[model samples]
Target: MSSSESQDETHLTPSALGTKAHWDSLYALELTNHSSNPSDIGTVWFSDSDCESRIYQYLTSDDLSLSPTTTFLDVGTGNGHLLFSLLEDGDFEGDGMVGVDYSEGSVELAKNIAEQTPNAEGVKFIRLDIIKSSTELDFFGSRIAEEGGFDVILDKGTFDAISLSDEMLDDGSGRRIYEVYPEKVAKWLKPEGGIMLITSCNWTEDELVKKMTSSNSGLEKMGRVKYPEFTFGGKKGSTVCTVAFRRKA
Candidate 1:
């Protein structure tokens, strides 16, 4: 394949949503709005599709056999709503949940919201850029670090935003930042039975599976969160897709 073709296959066009400034500014405004109205929790990202509820159902399903003590990490946890919702709707315990974001404003907003949320005392929100802090993932906490990794890691639109960035890795490999994302985050999962569930609106189910199961990611398809399918011009697809992966044995 030609270099251009390879680039096109691996990268998505850059957009403002891919930048930290965009989220910082938006979350800053949300923090202000939330101060006056505790009910205002900012954007839920794909709420129209009921993405969060479906994700919750998928985790709570009997097939997974996940328990309330299962540990979780939410990457790019904007407003930390996914983690919050899981605690609110599922039998999952809050002590085992954590949310991390690169934007300080996002962390602040989530932390503030947690204070007002019932049974949210154990949910911790931290600010860390997963891409840049690939070598320092131990910042999560002693429990997580001592446990080797989390039981499950979730990415709701985080990879989509990362893919939209045009930034390339600084390692002189000529690879875009998104290209290395799978390998970087996959290390945070426990080697035994850890799982990662990613929901994306930008990539098709096949594309998402390919990206997550790339050779270097050490992950394989475990399952998926099903959504209603629609046929457009005889092509069946959904507005979004959620895929689950587990570390290769």
Candidate 2:
């Protein structure tokens, strides 16, 4: 693995992790590591097995159905393993799948991984700062709209990253990026039945559901995937959660 993307962990402040430079540096190191060992894929959010199992189980469940023409969008797609898993193992024969991230290095690494994987043919990776408001940064948003929007949008850790970033609010009075995320995503998803699936470590299921149902978001909570339970100080909790929402018809 790349030295930066190694198993060794390090602590970072929210301010530091929120910058494009931070993620760029991380992926730059991972790209170098991937060059040496192309088989070693990096997982920035969580374990590959955990992500794959949960997403696959959700897609195949009666709650959601997929067809050959369904389209997918993956926000903040780190190493692109989620899409890889869906294509290679989940029988996802969708019309197309696109993965976007703010870090150019992250998108580059994703492209590299996609290029090397046979099942990832036609997968697209784009560099985009989705945290920025469309009024100031509308390129990615326009591109997504012009492409007819997506049937499913997957967010593994993008929202959590925004929630942890110090730059979430430029001014103390302005709305945070995390606060605008649901509405922004609503614009890129096909209405009526479009679905957005999120996996997070920083928020509980109820909190995410509340965010989705906020005024002007036009999203309704479908449900969430349960994780392994752990008890700490007599309280039950899980370190991670996956929640789903559908755009209003």
Candidate 3:
């Protein structure tokens, strides 16, 4: 559940990585572009859709066999690109696409983007702070349980953002967000083969699998998606990777 904790400025994004304000600021900039050309909603983290597209391929692959009605949830969904990508892919006629983020601006931006995309009518963009544990979360959790839980949950750098939070580095009590995320997310997913897919640049595939499985009691290592390779000083690895874990009964 520990990592080298990247201390390099190269990994630091211009906007603060792990805070509500950081995402708010990022969408504020992209909101301008979205207004000018509704189709130009900016992509953060990866410059291209390669990582996201690969994730869709993996889900639809023979292993997962994700269907149109699979009940998808995108945690910390920024601008809802991943959900939209899933919807737009050929042969994916899914419903109940949900995207939640802590930032109001981020949710608003996602809503705006969804409005422009024809197939995104069923998508739900909710402003919820998944990092917080409170009565409010309890209320939300009840509603999630009412819906019978999601079949698949996607985390595109959301856990990485949580890991980089100042609270995670602070005293032990402040570690609640990082510690509770996997548990809370697991609860929101339908058990007995429900999947949690995470795409991260901050953590390697091994680190991510360890973190999720260790923190969440019932998660089992399913598999991971391979991205383009990067070589630094002869050692070869990818700058980013997407990993999937399944919830067991």
Candidate 4:
């Protein structure tokens, strides 16, 4: 669980990414709401109705599926809503899940919620920024490697957080996201692990694959197979999410 975003950059905005202020404001509002409710941040734009239902479909399927004892990472875990959604799911059967976020308030709320929630076993929430190439990524990777690389890593809105403005993205961050992210995920993931990324960019599944082909040497170098995209709610067309999955290489 890692989040990467700085607060000072006001000029640059990738459409789907969250600024530090955005998160700060979100937590400021959520502070009054408390984290004990079934769903703390119910109306977050990131978890739009379409995306919300779509995420459940992903979780029930092989995207985040795990045994009774598999470790998981939920990136950009805002208010622990997505993670809580999984916890509330009647069909979930995983072990040792953790969420990471940048907002201190959100992180504290999430930690409190996970600690107090019923049936939320083996779940922990931490506060850390994944942007700026911080050690949080290394910290997660090392922690996983020390025990076991996460069997599954799920990114609900993180990359969308990275789907940035042309100028801010031009700072080598977007390309680095495309380059280092996949490899980094693989490094701390099991050989038979899974990575699921859900995004709302205009890029379709094939367009994303093509972009990744050029940006990520590790993805190209490793002979990993791409699973076909899964349509949510039996909808045929893309549903604001271009989810890509690959076995750890």
Error of model 3, residue 178, in angstroms: 1.8
TM per model?
0.95, 0.84, 0.83, 0.67
Clashes of each: 0, 0, 1, 8
Identify the leading candidate in terms of TM-score.
1
| True-structure lDDT of candidate 2 | 0.74
lDDT of 3 at 128: 80
Q: In angstroms, what RMSD does candidate 2 have relative to the true structure?
A: 8.2
- lDDT tens digits by residue: candidate 1, 1-249: 543344436457899989999889999899999998989999999898899999999998888889899999999999999999999865999998989999999999999999988889999998889888855446778888888999999999999999998888888767778887888899999998899999999999889888777648899999999899999999999999999999999
Please write out the lDDT profile of model 3 over residues 2-30, one tens digit for every residue. 33232211222323676777778888888
lDDT of 4 by residue, 1-249 (tens): 112242112222454244577777767677667634535543444543356555656556663455555567777677666666666765554246778777787776676666656677566777766554445334665557666556556666565555452323345443333334454444445545445454544555555454444333233322222233456688555435445555526
- Candidate 2: where are CA atoms >4 Å away? 1-13, 133-148, 168-173
Ranking by TM-score: 1, 2, 3, 4
Please tell me which predicted candidate would have the highest lDDT against the true structure.
Answer: 1
Query: Model 1: residues >4 Å from true position, as ranges?
Result: 1-10
**Which lDDT tens digits does candidate 2 get at residues 45-145?**
66743866787788877667676556788888889888887887646752378888888888889999888887677788887777574622234355446
